[model samples]
Target: MAASIGSLLAEISGVEDPIEELQSLKTALLSIPVSALRDSVSGQRFDVIFSLLDSNEREQVELCVDILERILMALSPVNVVQNYRVELQGGLTHPKETVKILALMQIGRVVEHPDAVTEILNNHDILRGVIHCIGEEMSVAKQAVQSLSKLSHSKPGLDKLFQSDLLNAIKDVMATSDIIRYRIYELLVEISSVSPISLGYCANSSLISQLLSELTGDDILIRATAIEMVTALAHSPHGRQHLSQQGIMDKLSNMIRGAETDPLSSLYLPGLVKFFGNLAIMESPQQVCETYPAFLDKVFEMALDPDPAMIGVALDTLGLLGSTVEGKQILQKTGKKFKAVLLRMSKHGSLGATNLRVRSLDAISQLLTLLPEQQTEDLLALTESWFQLLSNEPMDMIRNIITQPFPELHCSALRIFTAIADQPWGQKLMMSTPGFMEFILDRSTGQTKEAKDGKFQLVGTLAGSSTAAEILGSQHYLRMKTYLREGPYHVTAVATVSTEGAD
Candidate 1:
C-alpha cells in the first residue's frame, strides 16, 4: 500500500500543470476503491490525504473531502468511529453538502442503539455538527433532523434534544430563513410524533404553538408549507388530538373555500390542494372530503378551468385521490362531479398538453386499478362502470390512441389497458371491440422500450388472470399466453444459409 502511494506520487511529479496533476490523481483514485482496495490501511495513506487537503487547492481539498466520505461509507460505523473519529467529526461540518449527508448518515446508522445515543450525547462537537447540518442544505437538513429524531427514542437522548444547547442551535437557525425555520419545526414535529411523552418534551418549546398557528397564517403559501410538516404530525393519535384541540379546521377552512364561487375567479393553489388531497388519502378519504367539502369542489373546478396549470394540478390530485380503494369509494360518492372529472380526464387523455395527457391516463389507470385479492363483485362492477364512462367515444378513442406516433401517450394508454386486463368486464369489452385483440397480440405496435414494457404488462396481466382464459375465449387467450412466454421485445429469429457456385 505504501509502495502503491509512492508509485502514484512518483508518476504525478512529472506532470506539467498542478491542476491537471490533481485531477489525474482524483480520476485514478476514484477508478479504484482506494479505501477498500486493501485489507489494512497504511498510515502513509492518511499522510498523503492530509498533505493533499493542506495544499489548499480547491480541487485537491474537494477530492479529499469526497474521499473521506467514500471511506466512511465503505467502513462499518464502529470501524469508522474507532479509526477515523477525528476526520469523521470534521466531515460532519465539511463545506461540501454531500459529505455532510454521508457523515450524518454514518451517525444515524449507529445511533439507533441506546449506548450509541449516550456516547453521541457526550460528544458536544459531534452534536453541534449534526445540528449545524440542519441548516446547511435541504437534503442534508433532512438527514440531520432525522438523525436527531432517533436520539429521542430514549430518556437521556430526549434530554439532549430538548436541552438548551440544541434548542439554542435550532433557534439560531430559525432566525436565518423561513425554509430553515421550517426545517427546525419539522424536526420538533417528528420528535413529537414519537410518543405522548415525546410530544410533551417538544411542547416545552414555543415553536410548536408557532407552527400550529402558522397553519392558519394570513399568507396562503406559508400556510401550505406549514401544512407539509404538520401532515406528519397528524399521523400520530396524540398529534391528531393536539391538532383537533388547536383548531386545525380553522387553519384550513378559508383555503378550501376559494375567493369566488366562479371557477375562473377563484384562487388556484396547487400546493394548497395537494396538502388536503394527500391528507385525505392518508387519513379518512371520505371524512377529509366531508369535513372540507370545498376541497373536492376546488379539484373539480380546477379540472374544468381553462388554465393548463390548474388542469395539471387537478390531474395530479385526481391521480393521488383515485389510487386507493377508499379514495375510489370517496370519488364514487361525488356522483356527477366524479363523472364530470372523468369527462374532463378523457379530453386530456385523448389529446392535450403532453404532461396533462400523460397524467390523465395515469389517473384513469389508478382509478380503475384493483389488486386480484381486493376485487369483490362490487369492485369489478365499479371498474367496468369507470371504463365505460371515460368519454362518450371511450372504446374507439383509446383504440385510435395506440396507433398514434407519440410513444408516451401510447405507453400511458397501454398502462390503462394493463390496469383493466384482469377484470371480466374489461375482457368482455376487448372481445367485442374489433381489432383490439390483434393490437394486444401484435408486438410490433410498441415503438419504444417503455411502450414495449407497457404492452407486455397488459399481455402478462391478461395471460396470468384466472377469468381471462374463459372470457377472452381460449384461442385469443392462448396467443396472449404465447406473447408472455416470448417476453416484451421478442422477435422471431430467422436463419439463412447461403451457398456459392462451388457448393
Candidate 2:
C-alpha cells in the first residue's frame, strides 16, 4: 500500500493534468500509515514535491502545496519539522505569491503541533519571512496574519512577534488597502486576547487616533472593524485607560447620537453600541452616562429596532447599564416608554423575539427593584396586560414559554407572575382564567430553588385573597399547603398560616 501510494505521488509531478493525479495521490496517501509511507518512499516523494515549488506553472505549485499540506498533516510534526525545516523556510520566501501563502498555511498547521511551535518560533528568519509576506497581495496578507496569530499562541512566540518590526510593518500596510488594514487589526486583536500586553503596545495615541478617525469613515466595514478593534482593546485595563484618555467615549457617543439622522450610522450603530458597552465595563456607569447623556435613549431606540439580533444586543447592554445607580436613573427617565417597548417584545413568538423578550423581562425585573415605586407604577401597570396575554394564550404556548431551555425566561416569567399576584386587578384577572393556578402549580414542580420560592410566594399571595381563596377551594388549597410545607423556610411560614386558618 505504501509503495503504491508513493507511485501515485511520483506520478503527480509528471502527469499531463497534475490536479487530478494530486487528488488521486492525496486519497491514496491518506489510507496508508504515515510511518509506513515515510519508511517506504516519502523522502523521494518529498523531494519531487519541493522541486515543484520552484515551478513556473501556478497550477503545479498549487497542487504541490496542497499535496504537501495533506502529507504534512498526516506525518509527525516533529519529524516533518526536523527533516524539512530548510525547505519549508525557503518556501516562506518563495518569489511566487501563491507559494508563499500555501507555505504559510502549511506552517500554520505545523504551528498547531506543540513540538513544531518552538522550532518555528526559534527560526527568526522564517518568522521575519512570514511577516514580510504581509506586504503581499490581500489573500497572502490574510494567510500571513493567520500564521502569525497561530504563532502568537505561545508566550515565546508572542514575544518574538512583538520584538520584530511587526507594528511598523502594520503601519506600512495600513497605507496600502482597507483589506490589509482590516487583517492587521484582526491579527492585533487575536494577539491581544492571548497576551493582553499586546494591546498596550498597540494603544499608542497615534494608532488610536487613526482608529477613532475611521469610526466615522464612509466605508461601513472600515467603521465596523475599527469599532471591533477598539472594543477588543477595551478588554484590558491598560487599553481602556489609553482609549479613555484618547476620548473614545466621546466618539462613540457622537456616532450613536448621529445614528438617528445618518442612514449610514445604522450600518455601524450596533458595533458602536457594543464598544460603548465594553467601555462601560471599565468605566463607571455614571461616568458613561455623564459622557453620553443620550446613551440610554440611543440604546433603547436600538432595542426597538426591527432586527432581532440588534434588539438582543440592545437588551444585553440595557442589562449592563441598569446595574448601576446612575444607569438606572437614566433608564427611569424613559422608564414607561422603555417598559412598554419591552412588554410588546415579550409577547413576540419568534425564536429571536423570544430571546430578546426573555432578556427584556430580566432587565425590567432588575429595574423594578431599583426605581421608585411611583416612577415604576406605569411600568408595573403593564403587568395586567401581561396577565391578560397569558390568560388568553394557548396552553401549549404558555407551557413552552415557561418551560423553554433558558432558565432565565422561566424565572422571568415567574417574576412576572409574582408581579401580577401583587396587584388586586391582576389577581382578579388571573383567578378568572381557568387552569392558571394549575399551570403555575405544574411549573412549580421541577424549578430551581429560587423559582420554586417565587412560585410559592405567588400562590401564598393569591391564597390570601378571599376571591382567589374561594376559587382555589379546599382540595387546591390543601395541595398548595403541601407544596409550601415542602418548600424552604419562607415558604413554610406561608404554609403554616394557611393550616392554622383551616383549624
Candidate 3:
C-alpha cells in the first residue's frame, strides 16, 4: 500500500496534466483509511503533498491545498497538520492570487479542528495576511472573509483578529466596493455576536450613519444585512447606547412608518420590527410608546399578519409595549379591534406557533388588567367573542394553552383565565364550556404546588358567581369534590370554600 501510494504521488508531481494526476492522487489517498495512511508511510505522502504547495503551477498548488484540506478535515494526526503549518501560512502571501485563495480555504479547514486552532492562533501574521487579501479581487476577498468567519468561531482566534488591524482593513474594503460590503458586514456581525465589546470600535457616528444609510438603500439584500449588523451592535448596552445617541430609534421608527405607506418600504418592516424590538429593551415602555407612536401602530397591524413569524414578533413587540402603564393605555386606545385581532391570532394552528398565541393572549391579558370599571361592558363583549371563536376546539385549545411547557405561556394562559373570571358573563361562559370543569379538576390534581394553587384560585373565583354556583352544586361538581377529598391536601382546602364566602 505504501509503495502504491508513493507511486501515485510521484505521478501527481511529475505528470504532464497536473489536474488529472492530482485528481487520481486524491482518489487513491481517500481510498486509504486515516489509520492505514498513518501506519503505512513515514510521512513521505504528506511531504510529497506539501512539496506541491511550492509548485510554480497554480493548478497544482490549488489541487494540493484542496487535498490537504480534506486530509485535515478527516481527523488526520496532529503532526500531519503541524508539519505543513508554515508552508500553508506562506501560501497566504504567495504571488499567485489563486494559490493565496486556496491556501486561505485550507487554513479555514485547519482551524475548524481544535488542535490546529491553537497552532493557527500562535501565528498572528497568517491572520493578518488573510485580512490583507480582503482588498484583493472580489472572489479572493470573499474567500478571505469566509476564512475569517471560520477563524472567528474560536475565542482565541477571534481575539487575535480583533487585536489586529483587521477592522481598519475591513472598513477600507467596505468603502471601495458595495460588491464585497455584504460579506464584510457579515464578518463584522459574526465577530460582534461572539464578542460584542470588540465591535465598540465601529460603533462611532460614521459607521452608524453608514449602516443607517444602507437601511434605506434600494437593494433589499443590503438593507437586510445592515439590519443584521445594527441588531448585533444592539446586543451590548454600549452598542445600544451608542446607536440611541445617534437617533437609531427615530430612524427605525421612520423606516417602520414608511413601511406603512410604501409596499417597497415594507420589505424592511420585519427587520425594522426586530431592530425596534431590541432597541425597546433599552427603553422604558413609556419611552418606546412616546418615541415611535406610528411604529407602535404598525406593530399592532402586523400582529394580524398572515405569516406566523411576523405575527409572533409583532405580538412580542406589543407585549413589551403593554408592559407598562402608559404603554397599556396606548394599546387600549386601539380598542376592540386590537382585542379581536389578538383573539384571532391566539387560535393559530401551526406547531411552534405557541409563542405567537401566547404573546397574543398575553397582550390581551394586559388590556384586561388595564380596562377601567366603566369598560366592564366592553370586557364582557370581548370575552364573548373569545369564547365564540374558540368554541369549535375549545377544549383542545384551552388544554394546549394551560399545559404549555414554558412557564411564561402557561402563566399567560392563566392570566387570560383570571381576567375572564373577573367578568360575570365570562364566569358563566367558562363554567358552561365542556372541558372547563375537567381542566380545573385535572389542574387541581397536578403535582406542581403552583399549578394546584392557581387552579384552586380559579375554581374559587367561579364558585362565587351564582350561575357558576348553581352549576358547581349540581352533579357535575361531583368529580371535583371526589378529587378534593382524595387528592392533594391543597385541593381539599380549595374545594371546602363556601360559595357565599368565596367572593
| Each model's lDDT | 0.76, 0.66, 0.65
Best candidate according to lDDT: 1
- Runs in model 3 lying further than 4 Å from the true structure: 1-42, 45-66, 74-102, 109-129, 132-143, 149-168, 204-209, 216-221, 257-263, 278-291, 304-337, 343-503
* Local accuracy of candidate 2 as per-residue lDDT tens digits, 1-503: 66676677678658666667776776676666666655544454477678767777777777777677667766677777777878878887787876777678777877878977888877777777777777787788789888888877776665676555655655776677787666667777666655445555444414546766887778887888898888887787766776678877777887777777876666687788877776765677766766777776677777777877677778778767765555655555665776655555455432455567677666544443322233355554543443344334533444466677666667776665554454556555566667776877664353577666667776776565444556556777777676666653333223433555564
Q: What is the lDDT of candidate 2?
A: 0.66
What range of 10 consecutive residues in model 3 has the weakest lDDT sum? 367-376
- Count the clashes in each prediction: 0, 0, 0
1-503 per-residue lDDT for model 1 (tens digits): 43555565565555433455555555554666656644423343453554455444577677665655554555555555656556658768666665677678878865785444556777878887888888787889989988888877888877887765877777887888888888888888889998989998888777888887776567666766787777778778798777778777545656566446534333336666776787787678888888888888888989998988888888888888888888888889889988988988988988777788888888888899999997999888988888889766576888678778888888888888888888878888888888889978886787699988888888889888899888988899889888888888999778987888755
Question: Judged by TM-score, which candidate is best?
Answer: 1
Q: What is the TM-score of each candidate against the true structure?
A: 0.82, 0.61, 0.55
Of 2 and 3, the candidate ahead on lDDT is: 2
Of 1 and 2, the candidate ranking higher by lDDT: 1
Residue 127 CA displacement from its true place in model 1, Å = 2.0
